[model samples]
Target: MIGQVVLNSNIMSVNLGLGVVLVVQDGVAKVSGLIGVRSGELVKFKKCGVDGIVIGLLKDSVSVTILGSDREVQQGELVERLYEVVKVPVGYELLGRVVDGIGNQADNKELPIELMEKALVEVKAPGVITRQPVREPLATGILALDSIVPVGRGQRQLIIGDRQTGKTVVALDTIINQRTNQRPVICVYVAIGQKRSTVSQIAARLKQEGAAPYTIIVAATASESAALQYLAPYTATAIAE
Candidate 1:
């Protein structure tokens, strides 16, 4: 759980988890793979005829290798991943229309099923779409900006200018456009070296304009942890996806 784990190598056995062992007993002790357990220097668990052991100290998905006479830890056991957890996406397209959050099929009144994979904010468009032409115009949500500079869908708009030239303002306006158009694109703002007051102010503004649910902000001015800042966009993207 800490660094990297290879469960396939030390797979003792596979279990139906029906209070039974699926392997041949070697001696007085019988080890069950249905025991979802692990062992550190501190704790371990077992599912034998003794008192049911539940190791509370180790992290999730613990691995254990019990010792017994003439017993061997086998491999290639298929541990069923039949987890009960489920995640639902906010936005899903149906028919010919789009929708906002809360599982409403705003487009064609079609019901979306429980998605197996969580939605991602950003993903590579299908390979077939990669070669499509950028013919559709993407309104950047600002009248003044778009009148001066228009951005088409699949367009890469590069904002290159000196400080205080409204680079961030341009980005915000584009995000705002999505909400108005009913194709609300999620925004993940990574504010590097930004003032704390400025970040707070912008967050407040976004929430006021009903953009907080689809908006995520990460600022590097507060924490020294680089990992936090690095993974912030991916988290936001996953939520949007």
Candidate 2:
């Protein structure tokens, strides 16, 4: 007999299977009545049709970071638990495809079910002793960088400089060079807080260079929320793993 109930402007109750939004502030909402939920679990706002993630479990309510426009969330809105943590599609099929910050396919095509697998977006890094050693070299196709500052597989290289300094070009070059490598190397390019046009140009360039077949672009554009931009790198890492 459980159903939706509205107590007041600040509180609303729904069926036992659902939760009520208590307060929303700065893209985080406080919701109550959800049972057996864990942090990082995904939830949906029924009315707004947007998703959120449980970030903190309070005494009687849970803190949710909205994945979409927080302005759409209202007090007393019903929330449904997805019963799963945030996950991204990972596999060879993702190569040459563009995905959003949360792993949604953005290339306007249906993802092939058989070629994809879901992976948790958040995972702890393995201990140093258990990690693989970086012994093989990864050429960036940049003569100066490869000759003076060689990069190894599984190594991290940072290209930092002022705007319009070709930082993106360097990264794109590295991705393009992977195509020439003897061993197959999958490159994941995560664009956080960049403009949509910029991401599009990068994708087009990669395609023109014949590197699109081996590279995946995960873009969280500047117009997206901070939460999404923050999650972009983790989502990319999960897909790569």
Candidate 3:
């Protein structure tokens, strides 16, 4: 079982963690006195109510990217290791809902229904022998593209173009089209570094078009912390898988 430990330098113990903020940069904190902490592990500033992710391990200190406001975390504050990796909630109940990069509800409604499982943001891919081959065609409901470049079930297709070229529109349309598929297709829409107004517009459109029932919107808006934008895609992949 995993146990929680509060590190106090004054009263050191084997199970207790010892971490002190040595430096506070733009959005990262150099913490000292932490032992046996791994990269990607979550940590928190006890007095600031801010969490961080360990990004680099130095000889005497660990570089942690602050997940919230860095200005709130002061130097010499106590740092506690959560002893857990970054994770997000996953379940069918996430459908038709909106969440932030860390899986917090963003729709201004009650928390997402029945979040029965949590998945690590980063995980190893399945072996080839255990994975299904990408043989079946997956239509995008776009005539020109379907005629020119066909997409397969398990294929990675890139939609590349200059700015304002309707790339997002195409992707949104594809998600809308999945509503008519023979088998139900769960869709996850991830918006990274986008404006909150834009995300709200997309959500409204999806709901208006009757596609919101099976779609999950994961948003890390530009107004939020950069850590959230960095975690947006990984969180989406974890939930989708």
Q: Native-vs-model 1 lDDT?
A: 0.43
lDDT of 3 by residue, 92-209 (tens): 7788899999887999778743446888999998888988899887778899988899889887899999999999999999998887886647889999999999999999999998
Q: Which candidate is the best by TM-score?
A: 3
Candidate 2: clashing pairs of residues? none
lDDT value, residue 17 of candidate 3: 77
Write the number of the candidate with greater TM-score, choosing between 1 and 3: 3
lDDT of each: 0.43, 0.86, 0.86
Over 23-87, each residue of candidate 1 has an lDDT whose tens digit, in order, gives 32222112233344432111112232122122222332333222122133232223322222212
Return the number of clashes found in candidate 3: 1
Residue 31 in model 3: shift from native, Å?
Answer: 0.6
Candidate 2 similarity to native, TM-score? 0.90
RMSD for each of the candidates: 14.1, 3.4, 4.6
lDDT of 2 by residue, 35-70 (tens): 667998999999999999999998677899999889
Tell me the RMSD of model 1 versus the true structure: 14.1
Tell me how many residue pairs clash in candidate 2: 0
> Considering lDDT, which of the candidate structures 1 and 2 is the better prediction for this target?
2
